[model samples]
Target: MESESSSESSLEKSMENVLHLQNSDNPGLILVIAPLNGTNYLPWSRAMKIALCAKDKIGFVTGEIKKPSKNSPMFKKWRRVDSTFWESNGPLLYNIKREISLFTQGNMPLMVYFTKLKKLWDEVQCLRPFLVCTCGNCTCGASKAIADFDEDEKLIQFLMGLGDHYDHVRNQMLLIDPLPSASKAYSMALRVEKKKDV
Candidate 1:
């Protein structure tokens, strides 16, 4: 087993490689935050890929790295975690290297979140996204509220703070809330709002 420091270092290196890959333009970034193992991750990721590719003028690419098939000896070096992938919705400026399952481990110390936040903050500075979208609160139930007692609150705060800080600094930030595809909750909220408007 790799030490925590080494694991984090490796994760950052992988992200840099992905981000540095060639792309026609830099559409800035759309940072999606959700549980590493949650059921909604894959769908939300794919949907975001498609939406960005379809509508955004910038170009991007997406790829997945899961367990290598037994027949392919080249994949022997791939990480044993779940299928890690990135997809280009259409064309975008930057390639998204997902930071999945990296910080969600059990018994992690507080510094872990800070470290992740700093890394993401640096990414925002580097990518200079015109927009930063988070798919965070959409799948969350009332049970997942950001109260002080909740262990996940630290992560949640960091994710939210990333967008806020980016906006404050650049003054060009546009956050696309809970993409409409993730949950029925968004539809339900819209229904209530529509009823009120009528």
Candidate 2:
């Protein structure tokens, strides 16, 4: 009985390290991934692997990680994904990891994914040294587990009356996405591009 309880405790601790429930005085860094929706997971998961393998200074925080899993009881304390992930995606969720299928290369998926993500995080990485950038190996870290830009989209759109935060920036954006061709994905702001005139 004691061994069984001990084993559970060990598992809980390991999960806690992989997915923090809240910010600590020194929470290291946050790697915010998108929600576990079909459209968001692939790119976000790729971003997660790169961040995890690339840096010890940062960690991941995702809405999907909070959902229930086989060992749901272990993460009973992780019910808060907002305070935990610096943004909320509703109640705790988990197990979606099993549901995730590795995204393969076609048109060089990595090539395409990086292009979009880098365009988004490039500036953020360099400008905010203390941000996700500079804190990780690529010398740019932080965007690892950012709230799904899509999820944030709804909140931002719904709260349009709350005075815009990203609109000025978003409005100026002409739909050009950034690529992570370097193979190393670091968390940074974004690298916007001027739209090519048709």
Candidate 3:
């Protein structure tokens, strides 16, 4: 009995780290939650970034380790995405350039990240996105940092709650795991594209 009660308490605490039900109010924004670190980060991120922009929806990216400074490598890349990733997707560069402000700028502690994420969601209430996608180990360290017990389940439950908060019909909140391969990311991107077409 004690073990089960402890488990419930742990789950609630974990949810608090990732989500605050009261703060959930984005009607149509497709929030792309993702981690900044990983092997296939570039290809996966680039693919989804292009796909989201191509679909004419703003990709509000979160879960970055640190906000890019003016002198950061990421900033430099953002400056020259056109020439750099042109072969892959030329127009996405333009789209990112146009919507660059939507992204968070700097590194933060996990707790602060969640706080700011909630605030950003509230601020962008008017955008109204078609889908909210999560990518590449986006449990926001729930499995490790937040709680060791049922962290994955807590993350999924939190996401599902967000879907409800955003009024998503079903399957609108996507989880793209790039560890399997970039193919999975591409497949997820295609789904987003097809959904946009409809």
Candidate 4:
């Protein structure tokens, strides 16, 4: 009986150690030394793993520590630490935006340049998607308006990245009453390129 009781006490102590939070451990605590910029993913991840291991929290990320029931005492703390490790959208979004802003159609063919820009734009759209109304009774044109605005923004960015050789085409495209979608703009530029080649 005494042996069984001692084993039970040891198990409880182990559980307590797993769930224990040091005074410095909090949601706001920065775990790794370097924040994860868009680059340096491997090194950042390695450092983060090391830091989490040091804190006895690596299981939160490695899936060794499954989430307990909502009523369990460890639930909130687990959630807080887990969220901090996974919440990386802000840096990713910033990197995408920066890439879009810096993009330019240097010596590359129009098709290649447009394809690259389109990929970056698609990433941005996926990360920060527009909200669409799903209710059958919706009357406000807000969703369509938002979509149009997003397309227009993409069209402008596409045109802005074109070389000076495309100045006339870009200006003509801008003069349209409603801006063309980015794909339509790309098609227009492509036609111009074919003519120039001829």
C-alpha TM-score for every candidate: 0.19, 0.23, 0.17, 0.59
Q: Listing every candidate in turn, what is its Cα RMSD in Å to the true structure after a full C-alpha superposition?
A: 19.8, 17.9, 23.6, 8.6
- Model 4 CA lDDT for position 171: 97
Pairwise TM-score winner, candidates 3 and 4: 4
Model 1 TM-score is 0.19
Candidate 4 clashing pairs?
none
Best by TM-score: 4
Q: What total of clashing residue pairs does each candidate reach? A: 18, 34, 6, 0
Model 2: runs farther than 4 Å from truth?
A: 21-45, 52-77, 81-198
Ranking by lDDT: 4, 2, 3, 1
Report the poorest 10 consecutive residues by lDDT, candidate 4. 79-88
Query: Tens digit of lDDT per residue, candidate 3, span 10-103?
Result: 9656433323222332333333455322223455566667754553222224322222469754544333332222232234434433332343
The TM-score obtained by model 3 is 0.17
How would you encode candidate 2's per-residue C-alpha lDDT over 1-198 as one tens digit per residue?
Answer: 999999989976776665443334233455545643433555765775575445421333332344446477644544443233343323222222212112222343333544543333332322222334445564442464342442343223222221233345444332324322222121111222122122
In order, what lDDT does every prediction score?
Answer: 0.38, 0.38, 0.38, 0.82
Give the best candidate by lDDT. Answer: 4
* lDDT value for model 3: 0.38
